[model samples]
Target: MTKRDNASQSKQFSIYLRSTNEWIPVTKEQYKEHSKFYGSFRKKKQDHCKCTCPHQKWWFCNADCETCKYRTGGDTVSFDFMYFNAETAGITPLEFLESNVNDFTIDVDNKLISIEIIHYIQDVAPFILSVASMRLKGLTDTEIAKKLGMPRTTLLARVNKTADLIREKFPDYNV
Candidate 1:
């Protein structure tokens, strides 16, 4: 295949590793990983993509992907890049995205105070009282803890600490 064809084929698929919580765009070489398992179940005449999960089904296999015992237990919630920015600045993704990229002033002291996107994220996506809210929104303390590989209580404590800091920073915005 031409280099252009190869490159396009690579970006068409993605692999989500639950253990590391990383999603990598797949390539032809990596496609062999899926082929290893699928090859055993196929007839001699069938090619790689011709198989159910590889080409026909596109990553959905009742055994490995669907019927697998750990499917539900897996960390499949796609992490919002905005969430990370918000966490860093103590805010929400929507707030971060909506915030002014440049907070500048000429009339004041001429000093530039860079306002981090996290500040807006926190302001826009304030912490909710109900844990269920967090769970429903994919921000569960347990999930965060798992993502960070920490204890749930410890993660919750850290979240509370961040919330406290956000509250302290913005008195009017209660976290």
Candidate 2:
């Protein structure tokens, strides 16, 4: 079969094997059976965790609270604080991991400044915040433009505008 035909066939008949982390061709009946099993497993897992913290929901919880690294300690902050910081900063914890910021301080004082800046951007132009987040995810200008369905030049212009706004608003701090 041609490459396009193979691609179409795979899309039609493939089942992802979670254990092997790969997709394999399967009969329609087999795919249906697997989907039923997987759906139940997902629902069960979603309701497994019983933690009270808002950040400790089933999907995001590690399920080992006794030895969790985020537990209160000498230098570690609580998971709730970390979640709040990331939320206020307008990014996910995973996005913070992908960031270039060296000092990962979890205290409120340090995060407050960033949170203020993010809130300002969010208030002024929410689109810039989305574009900035995509940029933070290591997307190139071309890729960001394509994903946002805008021209490359328009994306560049928006980026420049955001920088200018930041510089104007927070002159003491470098952008």
* TM-scores of the candidates in the order shown: 0.24, 0.37
For residues 93-141, what per-residue lDDT tens digits would candidate 1 score against the true structure? 5455455333323323222221432544456444423443557777867
Q: Which candidate's lDDT is highest? A: 2
lDDT of 2 by residue, 1-175 (tens): 8999888667766665434557688887887777676455444443544233343332323334455333333334343444445345655555566553544554555678789899988887788878878889999989989999999999889879888998999897776
TM-score of 1: 0.24
* lDDT (CA) per prediction: 0.51, 0.65
The 10-residue segment with the lowest total lDDT in model 2: 50-59
| Counted clashes in each candidate structure | 4, 0
lDDT of 1 at 94: 49
After superposition on all CA atoms, what RMSD does each candidate show versus the true structure?
25.5, 23.2
Candidate number with greatest TM-score: 2
